[model samples]
Target: MTWKLGLYALAATVAAAPALAQDAKTLAIVVKGLDNPFFEQINLGCQKWLADNPGSEYECLYTGPASSADEAGEVQIVDDLISAGVAAIAISPSNAPAMANRIRQMAPSLPIMTIDADFLEADRDLRKTYLGTDNYLMGVKMAEEAAKLKPEGGSVCLQLGNVAADNINARAQGFRDTASGEKGIERLTGQKGWTEVEGCPVFTNDQADLANQQMSDVFTANPDLDAFILIGGWAQFAPQAYAQVTDQVMDKLKSKDLIIIAGDTLPPQTQAFRDGRSHAQVGQRPFEMGLRAPDVMLQLLKGETVEDPLYTGLDVCNQDDPGFCKDN
Candidate 1:
């Protein structure tokens, strides 16, 4: 039999089904949104796993909110997935705190884990384990890369997704701590020759268009801004706008007047790096996360004590180097 993978939103996949239908056990992979290419790679990973293990009874049901900004919608989808009685669940929460609260309220009997992002440390026990990148280290790599291009620290901006996202926050903190040359500093403000410039640390809420506009606005406000660290690849997701904006700053980039170290090496983002729009990229392996999630959750279902926080490592590359995507 030929099996196909399709994007299943909550309503179409879960609500339409009878509660806990017994036809085939479901392994649900919930991401922050349906729009991001990063998440699409994850879906592809899950599909690959299914293809490899043909004739398996488990069905990989990948779903998420229509938009990355819809934090509440993601939580609702998780709740509905639970109610639909999926055999196991792997979620990447957009808003970690709210999702943790929902999990506590419902207290699902079936096993649940996190992918790409996890609940905050205070709420760590709520999930079986987390499978994703070492976000803080990912940020540290970005900082290190930026420092290489411009040894003298200068005014900068941090491009992030939702303010409440645990993964994005961790990455931001890592960048700040490493860039400031001080460990555990709460915020970067004139520390060790580095200061996150005023009107900086702009939050894009994971929208590609908004991210590009934010970059343009920040650059406009601070023409002398030395560097930018994109904790998420929002702007680069839209390659054309990214190219246009980078074209404007190409002179600075060439002169080392401005350095950009963005996250993720998806096709478009990598092409942007090749075009010299971004100086470096520190990316997470969402495909690996998706591939490992099903088997990990299955082990949890069998009452096995799996390792918590299965880190899927990083892929660092610069304009001069192609990173791990070179293999593909």
Candidate 2:
């Protein structure tokens, strides 16, 4: 059959019959790292959106950096869901290039949508639609915010997702370009850390935490370290962790102040502010994106041709911003 015909058949097969039946139809969500509240929040947002839509179902599955899944987990989940005949698969790919082939292998009779993060060199031909923030721009915004906070400039650290992931790479590049261009900013590399207590497998949450701990040590080793910026959730938990380290380092330093900044927004980061742990966060509207993603996916499943790209929003949350007391 023609590609166009195949695409139609795929969307129709999912949207028609039980896929569009009176009861809810499943939209399998495959995501990275359920270790933190960030994923939980995103899941809640997606669920809320699906709930509002009604007659739609969702199942949450973790495709973390563990041995069981990793990128393979996401690919398998999509494949399994397709085989089980779910209405749609809304994925936040763990590794895009590695998983793209598996995603593309899905029967042309299935509707697939991506959100939160994207696959490397995604087959736009295979996906019904995509909904997420401009990750690179968000990174630039974070760097700009850090520059504003520290005019003199200093070393900034990156707490990344997966190094191979396209979205994180883009964000890191944007941050590196912006900070390196600044007269005084220096970019610091992150330490590989574990997320869980046991630290069995390396994950973003672990990497983020390790990045924070390394920054703390940097501050201890070099008391003059001026500013530290983390472009991941690491900064959210770093304040308390660093506060302890900073308190120890401060006793021996003439100048003991360090500025902390982060990229993504999470509830813990906001809480850190309440306890005086963080300075600022570059917030992505994940909840809003969640609500919108399903709407976009539903349209695609129904065979309504959508625009090539869709916008999910973002903003900066700081002490000055209203998110101070409100959940970020």
Candidate 3:
């Protein structure tokens, strides 16, 4: 071949090398569920990372179940990703224990990381690192926000979602501990600091309809209920919850007799807060979690150590200062 042609051929090969290498390696992002905008934000974060890192030699694959409670479905998706020979996996599990077990089963073969939620402390060795909010701190923030509204303290119901998940349990306990410590805020049930309302916390399984029903039942049973501390924004995300809230709690809200605080500032929740339906929301960095997970996974794959239980900070959004929630 001519000298000039040979040089051109070598340059072409060099330019194609990175693309070929990237096409071989795959990074799978498995989240809890795509139904919620939080997870959708996570997906977007992953995409943004991929776009920002132009030289990264890995193909990103994002997937999740339709519902948050589908542990088996999430497990199956991970299994599929593993079988597809993905170089690494980042997942936000529905059931932390089951996810830990699955990760252990595939250990030393694929690098697995957690996002948005984490495995139990005992199972920390299973995943490379956890990239998400500090649930306990998030709960504390929620309680602080509640105190701002009702400084004198009053009766409040706690709406929890999927008590089995690590994040859910942590936030519930954090809120309980903080609220209990507030002498002015009185818990009306015998379920200790954690489950103090309606005898026990209402678990919504991350379903909006179930959350609405539980909220309604609690409201009916305790007509004098002063506030609702939602550990998860389940009802706000569901369309059915709109009517239920309007019918059962709107009058009380308008009268300033009832206060509602929730976590996660998605479009629906932000709109509700703007409309004066909810008092405040605890904002989680789902997009940041998504953006960070892949970076951590890449580090793990390179045999570089990363911080375990990495936190993606929290923010409180209300009508006055909406923060990022205002974007919705």
The lDDT leader among the candidates is: 1
**35-133 in candidate 2: lDDT tens per residue?**
544555555555455434445454322233333225566577667777877777777776776667776665755777777777665465667666777
User: What is the C-alpha local distance difference test score of each model?
Assistant: 0.83, 0.57, 0.75
Q: Candidate 3: where is the Cα deviation over 4 Å?
A: 1-22, 182-195, 319-327
Assess candidate 3 and give its lDDT: 0.75
Off by over 4 Å in 1: 1-22, 325-328
* Candidate 1 TM-score to native: 0.91
lDDT, residue 226, model 2: 52
Which of 2 and 3 is the better model by lDDT? 3
What is the clash count for each candidate, in the order shown? 0, 6, 0
Extract clashing residue pairs from model 2.
10-109, 69-73, 96-120, 193-206, 194-206, 195-206
lDDT, candidate 1, equals 0.83
Cα deviation of 323 in candidate 3 (Å)?
4.0
Tens digits of per-residue lDDT, candidate 3, 45-85, equal 66666666666677666799998778789988888888878
Per-residue lDDT over 1-328 for candidate 1, one digit per residue giving the tens place of the 0 to 100 score: 0012222322243333333324768999999999998898788777766666666778777899999999999999989988887889999999999999999888645588999998999988888899999999998999889888878788889988998899999999899899888888767887767788887788999999999999988888889989988899999999989888888789998887999999987877767777778888887788778878999988998899999779988878875677554533
TM-score between candidate 3 and the true structure: 0.85
Pairs of residues at least 3 apart in sequence or in different chains that clash in candidate 3? none
